[model samples]
Target: MDSVSEAQFELDQLRHQARKQLLGTVVLGVMAGLLAFVGQSALGQARPLLESSFGTWQSLYTVVLWALAIAWLVALIQQALHYQNISEQFESRRRLDAVYAERAAKAQAVEEERQRQRAESEARQAAERNRRLNKNSHSTKFDFWQE
Candidate 1:
């Protein structure tokens, strides 16, 4: 409900998202590497066929390896971008907290000042009323301590 809590929740969400993305990148990278290894061996076994079909097994293997390398790089970039997102969210939350705290503090100070002024005014009025009453009483010769 509060701004502070909302910001914290958003920050936590971003952190979780970034972690998931990073984990996905690692898994994908490992998978790509494994595929490359298997592909190279298969290419070796089918050397004659590959050469006859596309000129050379080495060519086929190289092309496949390059493709896999590209995929891996893409995944790595995604992971880095996710990390950046998390950092940006964290910084944003920090700024929000600081701004909110400042506003609350200023409001409290203003309220206290207002209360102090009101109390002082009330005290001054009470004293003025007492002076007026005393003057009237003396003129009337009131409170002679008579029975």
Candidate 2:
């Protein structure tokens, strides 16, 4: 495919991937919250185990989640900017095409008008020449037959 089609395809893929990531992130966030709630209340006997695990890993897990979230945000921003650039390029190209088309039409109209004026001038000159020739012929020996 052409470059335009390729870029469009890539944009579409990115859009789909972004959507999936967003949904997955939301669902995972909800599940994590629910798990935390259940563990805090319903599983009292497991508090020591959970607390130890949390103490050992919660900070690290939080950092990792934040990093992933930031990366996703950056990807989304890049995608939006890229899409905007492509849209601007298309808009400028359309405007340029319109300007070129208008110029061509104007040139064609001017050329046609010029040709019409030239034709009219030539016709008037031919008529004037014929009139002179007829007048001169009548006053010359060429008119003997008429006399």
Q: lDDT at 84 for candidate 2? A: 64
lDDT of 1 at 66: 90
The TM-score, computed over Cα atoms with residue i paired to residue i, of candidate 2 is: 0.57
lDDT of 2: 0.67
Residues 1-147, candidate 2: write the lDDT tens digits: 645555556666665665666566666666656666574454456556778676446555556657766766666566666656666655565566667668979999999999999999999999999999987766666666776
**Position 75, candidate 1: lDDT:** 75
lDDT scores of the candidates, listed in order: 0.82, 0.67
Model 1, C-alpha of 3: deviation from truth (Å):
4.1
TM per candidate: 0.70, 0.57
Tens-place lDDT digits, model 1, residues 10-90: 888888888888888888788878987897787778776766675565776788789878877987887888788888878
Q: Which pairs of residues have clashing backbones in candidate 2?
A: none
Note the residue pairs that clash in candidate 1.
none
